[model samples]
Target: MKILKRPAGLILLLLAALSFQSQDGVAGSNLLFYGLAALALIIFFYIVVSVADNFMVIESKQIGVKDTGSMGLFPSFREIFRPKKPEYLEKAHVYTLTKGYDIPMAGEPREEIREPKVTRFALTPPDFFGLMPIPKMLVEEGDTVKAGDPIFFDKKLNRIKFATPVSGEVIAINRGLKRSIAEVVILADNEQQSRDYTLPAATASREELVEFLLESGAWPAIRQRPYNVVADPDVVPRDIFISTFDTSPLGPDLKLTVRGRMDVFQAGIDVVRRLTNGLVYLGLDGRGEDPSPFEAINGAEKRYFRGAHPAGNVGVQIHHIHPCGAGENTVWTLGVEEVLLIGELFKNGRYDTTRLVALTGSSFSDPCYVKTYAGANIAELLSGAGEDIAENARVISGDVLSGTQKSTDGFVGFFDNQITAIPEGNEAEMFGWLLPLKPRASISPTIPVLSDDIEITTNTHGEKRAFVVNNDYEQVMPMDIYLTQLMKSILVNDLESMEGLGIYELVPEDVALAEFACVSKQPLQQILRQGHDTMIEQG
Candidate 1:
C-alpha cells in the first residue's frame, strides 16, 4: 500500500486489478468497455459543440419589391441534398422586358445634331490573338469612302473593314490619344444605302465551325468564364451554357431578341453541342406555365433559377449545379443575344456579329431597340439618337446593376447587348432612410410590401451596405459549393484554403450581384477573377 501510493503506480495497480477481475468473470470486460465509452462520449460532445459554433449562416432577404409565393429565405437542406426531379420546361414565353427602378444620369446638355458621315467597322481583326495597333493607312486621311470599304487592317494586311452606316466622305482620320490608332471620321453621304444578307445555318465540326466564325468575325459573341473574356476557340470547354433571360435592371428581354430566330437558335445549340462532351444547359427564368422556346432541341437539358439579380447568371447557375474543380479548366457561357450569333454561323458559315440592342431610360427621349453589331462604336450608334434623350444622362452599355460606363470614344463592349441611359442621381436625398417606405423605393425585401401593386421602376430601393445576412449562396446559387468560405479564402490569397474551398469553380461574374448590393463594396468580381488567374498561371 505504501509503494502503490505513487500516482502512476497506483493507476497501474488499479488497471491490473480490473484486468484480473474481468478475467475471473466477476466484473467482465464490460467495465473496461464502459470506461472507454464514457471517454469517447466526452470527446464527441466537445467536437459537436465546436462544429456548431463554427458553422456559419450567411443570408440576404428581399425587402419590398413583388414577392411571389416563395416558401422561405432559402430552400431546406434536405431539399438541396435530395433534389426533387425538376419538371423544368424551357419557358416558351420569353420575358421581353424587366420593370425595375434606375437612377437617371446627370450631365451637361449636348446638342441634338447628327454626325454627317458614320463609318461602320467589323468588331474583330483577322489575327485577333496577336496584339498590334489597328492599321492607319488603309484609307487616306481625306479619302471619300462608301459603305463596305476597307478602313483598317492588321499586320498581315488582312483588311479590317467598315461600311458607312451612313455613306459619307471622310471628314478626318482621327487617332485615339491613348492607343494611337486610326479613327476614321466621315460625313453622312446619304440616308438611302442599305445591304442585307440572309442568316446562315449549322453544318460542320466544332473546330472547323469555330475557325469559320473566327475568320468571319463571330467568335467575339461567345464569352468564356474565369476572365469573362471572349472565348478562345482552341480551349474546348466542359460545357456551354446559354442564358435566355437577364434579371439585372434595364437588361433587354431575351424573348424579344429571339423573335423569329428559333431556327437559328436551335441550329446554334446543335453547333455548340459538338464542341463539348458535356450536356448543354439552357437556362430560362420562368414558372410552371410558360411556353418554352427551347423545347425541341434533342440532347439538350433545360433548367431554371428563379430569384433576383444573379438568378440569370450562367456562372451562378453552374455554381448551383456542377461546380468547377481545382484542375478543371474552362466553361463557355453566353446570353441569348450572343447565342443568336451562333445561329447565324451555321446559317451563313460566316461571323455576323450585327444584332439589335435596346436604348432605354427616363432620360432617354426615345426608348427603343437599335440595330447594331458587337464592337460597333457608340458614336456611330448613338449619333442622331443622343438628342432624343435627356441632356445629362449616363449611358451604360449593359445594365444599371452591372453595366460599365463608357465614354463617347468608348466602343461597345464585346459582351453588351443593351444600352441604358439613366439619370445620374448622385444628389443626396433628404432623410432618405428616415422616411416611411413607399412603393417608389426599390427594396429587396423578403415579404411583399403593402403597396405591392405599383409598377416598380429601374431603381430597386436599398442603399448599398455590408453583407449581413446569410444569403445561402448554395440555394439561389445553383452550384454545389460554399460561396462565403470560398470568397473569404480567395480574398486573403490563402491558396491552400482556396484549393480546399473549390476556388476553380467560379469567376467574378458569378458574384457580380453580390458585389453590387454589398455594403463593403468589395471588388468581389476582381477577387474571383484573380483567384482563377492565379490557378491558371500556376498550372
Candidate 2:
C-alpha cells in the first residue's frame, strides 16, 4: 500500500498493466517493458491522485475540504513538489526559467553608432493606445515648431499633449481611413533647436509629477497593465518596472544603448521613482557579461533573469517579481530609452527625443546602430547601409516575433528600438513543407535545427487551421498563463473566462512567441488585442 500510495495513479497504472498484459493477444517480455515505460512516461497529473488517496487528501472540491492551503482546482506540477514560501518575494530574486523559445536570425546590428540618413520624422497616433484614432490637431502643415512643441491632443483626455521629437516644420498631417490622423510628419531642420521645460524636483508630489509628464509629452512612455494601454493619469500605479535588456531575435543591444549614458538613464529612473509610491524595480539581463553598470544604478531595486527571448520582456519579469494585479491593481512599465527621455527632460532641461535604434535582419548589407529620433523614416534609415535592398523585403518595427509591418515609406514606431528587414516568403518552396529541410530558425523537432542563426523567410509552411489542442503554445511560453484557453476564450468573446484566465497580464508582444510556435497558425496577438478591445469597450 505504501509502494502504491497514489490510488488513482495506481488504478491507471493497473489499467496500463492490464492493457499491456493483453497486448492485443500477443505477449512477450517487450510488453512488460512497454508497461513499465508507460508508467514512468505518464505521471504528471495522476502522480498525485493515487498519492493523495494514500494520504487521505481530496483531489477534488468537496464540502469542508481540508484547508492545508488554497488547493489547486486540479493537479499541477506544484502538487508534486510543495509550493515554496514567499521568502524571495521581498528581496531580489534570480530566476532561471526552463521554458521559453529563442528565435535566432541573421543580421545582428554592429555595436558602433552611425549617423542616420533620416531628414524627416513622424509621430503616428495609432502607435499609442487608449486614444481616439484622430486627436484634435494643434498645428497645421507649414507651421514651424520646436522639439517640444505640442502637435495634437486627445479631446477625451485633453490635458496630455503630444510633442514633436525634433524641431521642424509640420510638413504633412497624414490620414488613413475615416481621416484618422496616421502620422504627423515633420521635416527636420538642419540645425535643431529645442524648447526647455520646467523640470519638477525629485521630491515632487505624484499629481504634480504626473501632470508634468503629461504636459511634457513623456507620459506615453508609461504604460499600465491589466490592459497594455496608456497609463491613466488619474490612477496611481502600485509599482513601476523597467527591463534593461532585449532578448528578442536580433534585438537591439541595450548595453550599447546605455553604456556611455548611464547617468542619463539613472536620471530618468530617479525622476520616475516619484510617480509611484511603491518601489521601482529594474529587470536586468543575467546572461550578459558580469558587473554591468546598470546593476550599480540608484533609486531602483535590481532583479536578474537569464533565459531565452521573453526573459527580457517586462511582462514576464513582472509576473515573477510581482504577479500583475491583473484588473485589480495597476502596474506600470517603460523601456530604457523612454527612461532616458524622462531623465533628459528633467536633468538636461530639454525634450531630447534621440534614441539608438538597431537596424537588423538579413535584408541589409551592413547592419548597425543608428542614432535617430522616434518614428524616423524607415526608407531613410535603411538607405545608409552602403547598398540597396530588394523592394519586397518585409520591414518590421521591433523584433521578428512581434513587430509592426511597414513599407520603406513607413516610419519607425513610437515605442520601437529596432527595425528588422527579412525576405518575404511569397513563392512556394519545392516540397518544403513536406520535408522542411530549408535552413531557418525553428523550435519544432521536425525542423532539425542545427544552429540558432539562420536566414528567416516569411513562408508560413501552412495556412491557419483548426485549433490543435495541445501544449505546443506552452512549450515556448514561460509565463503560467493558459495561452490556449485564453486565446480560445478571446475568440469566443468569453469576458468572464478571459478575466479568470489572466488576460490582463498580456499585450501583443508578450504573446508573440506563442504566436510563432502556434501549430494552428492562429494570430494570437490579434486575438489578444480583440479581447482587450472588447474589455476596453465594455469598460
Q: Which number leads on TM-score?
A: 2
Residue 31 miss distance in model 2 (angstroms) = 25
Writing each residue's lDDT as its tens digit, candidate 2 over 1-539 gives 34364345566668576756665665756776777667666665465654664354354324434232335433444445744423433244456666788876888878878876678999999888878998999999999999988899888889878899999899999999999999999999988898878777756787888888898888887888977778888877889999998888898878888777889998898888888888899998767445446878999988877678788999998887777865446889999888999988888888888878988888877788888889899888777645356567888898888889998899999999898888999977888877776786667776777866788888777799999998877788888889999988998989899999988888898999888888789999989989999998888
By summed lDDT, the worst window of 10 consecutive residues in model 2 runs over 60-69
Task: Report the poorest 10 consecutive residues by lDDT, candidate 1.
Answer: 58-67
Per-candidate Cα lDDT values, in order, are 0.55, 0.81
**What's the distance in Å from true for residue 414, model 1?**
2.6
What lDDT does model 2 reach?
Answer: 0.81
By TM-score, how accurate is candidate 1?
0.62
TM-score, model 2 to reference: 0.84
lDDT per residue for candidate 1 within 92-142, as digits (tens), equals: 322211222222222212222223223443233321223245554566656
For model 1, the superposed segments whose C-alpha errors exceed 4 Å read: 1-206, 325-329, 376-387, 433-491, 530-539
lDDT of 1: 0.55
RMSD of each: 13.0, 7.3
Cα deviation of 135 in candidate 1 (Å)?
11
TM-score on alpha carbons, each prediction: 0.62, 0.84
